[model samples]
Target: METESLVETLEAAGLSPYQAEAYVALLELGTASATDVAEASSVPAPRIYDVLRTLEEREYVETYEAGSLQARAHSPSVVLDDLRSRANRLEAAAEEVERRWEQPELEAGGASIVTQFRTVIERAESFIEDAAHQILLSTTVSNLQRLAPALRDATERGVSVRVSVHTDDAETRPDPTLFEGVCVEARHRPLPAPFVALADRRRASFAHHPDSYDRYGVLVNDRTHTYVFYWFFLTTMWEPWETVYEATDPGLPTEYLDIRHLVRDLRELNWQDAPVRLRVDGYETDTGEERTVEGTVVDVRVPFASEADTGFELAGRVTVVLDADGERVSVGGWGAIVEDLEGTRLTIVDAPTVE
Candidate 1:
């Protein structure tokens, strides 16, 4: 390193500018009078004595009266050790910066904006690991591989994990075997899509594709915010995609946190004339009063055309007509207004008994 840069580095390592310059000069001179060091370095002759004395106190130099007061640089071993320690600290700090850039910490109960897509993926993995009931994830096949372990663990714990794998084309689609045990179902989307992960309706992670003009990510722990991302996943990445992999039916008594999913399953069961019983847990839409209703599902209604499946459109109503004892109660999903009850948890209490 240049002498000037060496002096600057020494200053950064806790030595004053004059002390650093004087020490550097004495090292070069072998041993020098205070006046000689000032002439050799940029330090002023008037301040050289005090600067050398301070360096001596710091053990960077040993000063003694050699005819007149003289300063000699400390052993190179001691100085080199201090410089090496500083370098090691700086290297560790650099690693920490990169780690935070990739896996930034997200605060609880709100949304955070981050600059790296990796941050969203890491947050999503954490949410998947903690997921109790359900997970909806839309990402590239490579990211699917990265999160496979966490998703598999969630499935082993009985969490419903649905993955939408986006690819550039059918030619680029991954093998179905890749998702066999990692998720309950895997869908193939033939277009580039933003990464999204929603866990148990409460936490969500979203990020634009790296190719996007504005690259960023959002981590959300609020139910309300995640609900929006859930719809985005449904309309864009999920409902429209073709199913590539589905686990063998671990048939009934299955539980659903999404009323839309519940409605879809009920539609199929009703077509086969299967008897469906449910334990509906939620709040009364009108009064926000909690209610649990155990009944048989009599009807599944979606306000679109009779033949139309509940696809991306959310403009119409989707209701489950439940016969509770003698009274018929209309149950709806998250933001239910037309229905009497807003269902939060729906468990199929009876398995299909179709012949």
Candidate 2:
């Protein structure tokens, strides 16, 4: 087994079996004459000189006395150092060649199907690492566990990460503890089969075999296809699942952020012509005093066409609340809608199903 391993290693390193065996024999014997090396290594006596000479040329062996047949194996340290140096030189040359190489342009609407499970996971990880703005992803609980570390790393780098997980297993439900500090938000729903990841709305991948060990998937780069997938994620996978976790930065109160999401839910529900039980607690426009309104949403409008209407252009005083009669009031000036609405606790009842 040792001899076979040595021969294989030597062959991999560009040495012939005879040269490797001869070198190994010399190393074992410490020092030997050419005839002794051939007998010990089982090399044919006639060809031993040729093998030794080749090893000598490669500095794997050194003839002690140039005029005589005596030879010694190069010190293992010396041989390893030479090999490392050669490898580093080759790597540098490769980098230079790669720098000059031109990649072929990939035309739009081309899709590549990968049948390997590892390949799909590798592509998902690659997209997560490359994401700059946000990641929209849905998979099973086990799969989320597999990707949690990469997702955390991306979040730490200031990339936003939103994940939806489907779990049939009762023992695990997309453990948010795994991504406690890094993930921006995460939710759990029934298994959203065919795991998918859409990054920055630019790259997308969909698995055909999410539940099986033998997973097959398609990696898509076409913008149009990715956008379609993105909408599917937003409407189907992301919007329906209850948000199990949300990590907000220091500036905004956690409750304030909650209001933002709930308000968005209300807006979307209203847009679908569904009844919503959303109530807001804030200063009334007429009385300039704290008030509460609880009823079905009549209309939620963004009255300020641009920042110029608010005079504080960057403040983003865009959120306007209206009842059934078209009565409207600004929650917060420009950018502080949710924060402004949180003068006191606001109760938003569970949204009615949009059928």
Candidate 3:
């Protein structure tokens, strides 16, 4: 496997470029003077003193009176152990700040999220409140399934917890409900997303994907971001309890059925080039133009958020996937052709099932 990204790993492990260089040089040469370290590390002699000082404080390097200040590198494991112990202290400090202080401008920004899955659960559990209006969160199944307790604990604390899940394997036992003070429902949707957390919609957290060794997340406490996502992208389900089966009558257009069934048919018929179907709820309040909209996926270019850069347009036909209430949402052909991708939202333009 490729080694960790050197610049990122060294910085994360608490090393300045100069310090990291000095340590690596010491490791290479066994023991070296400041001048030797400077040469080996390619750090200038003037900056080497500051780097050595920081490394010494972090316990990654040791220095002695050897004819002009010789420095020695600590073992990798030793350096990491110290780094971790310091990290624990820092985490404790962060939790205290997260609790005791209202604003933590002085606290380090975005460094102390727990990495281990169980540890993340424990951290969430620790922060959970017993009041009714506590935290509101949504989770994908790929995550949180292992440490399902986080959801349960939040609910047990009477926090309003809303959950949506996507599953291809419908054969498993009914997944246990993870909350008590709130609603937990199971529904199938797209690939579960990572890093979705909103607390009371006033403060939100984004889960940054973990490093390859251990998965982790970054928490964003931005409220505007939370509000935008809540209104637009991360929609919580407001639907019926039972599975709404399709009508047996052939009068309806074939495209307006549950997308699960359509994908099944595609796989069953061995149609290698089937268009990606749009799963849409019927629409009302239209000029009847959408009634004849094709359900087949088409090529449409979607732009990334850029003005100067030519953007990504989804390749697919315009089709109405879901037309519930006033809004409609659909997946554009992922690689469609379009002049600009920035403003394009709907992919499959369509009419209602019946006017």
Candidate 4:
């Protein structure tokens, strides 16, 4: 039974039955001539030399000569090590080819749907593995646990990973330590029914929770629907108020009610004809210089429901334009970051010139 199992294992590892039997015969015999190997194993005399020669080439056996044909089996450890190295080289080559290969444009625009829970999990894993730039995941703690390996792989590759963990009930909340060092940014938010994953803002997957046992999900590659998911994920699911970065300054206060009112009042100010004067101060991100300027508010760009195109998609980003010291300057970041800046206050200097 043991010999039979060995033969089967060797065959599964790409060795021919004749090669497997001959190699095992040599192992048992300690050393053997070609004819002796054929007698001890099932390999025909005519093919035994070829089988042994092939095994020798694969590092599974070594050839020897002592005035006649001889063969010896290498230790299994040495043979497996060689096979593992070869497999690693093949995997690296495959990755390089995939990296340089251009995918043919699909007629369906890459849109797909899977109606099985297992398939949904598989697709999500594939998306995470193929991520190049960024990955956004909004899921419950239970689902995040399933995807931990793939998420860790993406983070190790330097992909920016942002996850918003949620819960169906308060008692099932996530363990914060599970996400440590595996995500660039992570936060907790109310669970949005159904799980969502967006990769590179170009592809997305949505699926029902495994606990529901329902088998259905979507793999969206159509640019329009993918963009819709991206917008929704960034705007609603990953809202700034809900996002609490681990690296964010903890010393900063969390109260923003007063700032919100201040922003609203600033926007409501009707500087119809004349520019509204204001004071602004913040460090220049590029130069690291302390910048302070008193100038008229050229434009107050707020993230509202109805606004003209300003090249920003997420809400709550309030960009203020100012003509400071005769130079038009524009600055904006996350609402929290922008509002938290030191010495950033707006005051009416010359009110509308009395219109």
Name the best candidate (by TM-score).
1
Per-residue error (Å), model 3, residue 235: 2.8
Q: After superposition, how far is residue 246 of candidate 2 from its true place, in Å?
A: 6.2
Candidate 1 error regions (>4 Å):
75-109, 250-257, 271-274, 279-295, 298-313, 321-331, 336-355
Better of 2 and 4 by lDDT: 4
> Mind giving the per-residue lDDT tens digits that candidate 2 earns over 223-287?
67876776677666776668778785422222322233444445544533665545555454444
Sort all candidates by lDDT, best to worst: 1, 4, 2, 3
The models' CA-based lDDT, in order, is 0.84, 0.64, 0.45, 0.66
Candidate 4 lDDT over residue span 1-355, tens digit each? 6999989877866788999899889889987888999999989999988998999888888888888789888778877886577678879989776543422222345766566555556567778999875678888777788898999999888676888887665456567687876676677775545688877545778877666667577777665676677666666566543554553343221112122333454444554345666655444655545566667767766767644332334446666667778887765532223432322233344544232
4-63 per-residue lDDT for model 1 (tens digits): 898899999989888888888998999888889999999988898899888888778999
Candidate 3: regions farther than 4 A off: 1-134, 168-186, 207-218, 232-355
Q: Note the clash tally of each candidate.
A: 0, 4, 42, 0
Minimal lDDT window, size 10, model 3: 336-345
* lDDT value, candidate 4, whole model: 0.66
TM-score of each: 0.79, 0.53, 0.30, 0.45
TM-score of 4: 0.45
lDDT of 3 by residue, 70-184 (tens): 8887667877776688789889989886654332221322224443444444333333343233344444455546435555666666444554443334453234443222333
Off by over 4 Å in 2: 64-68, 82-111, 116-122, 125-134, 145-162, 169-187, 212-214, 234-236, 239-355
Sorted on TM-score, best first, the list reads 1, 2, 4, 3
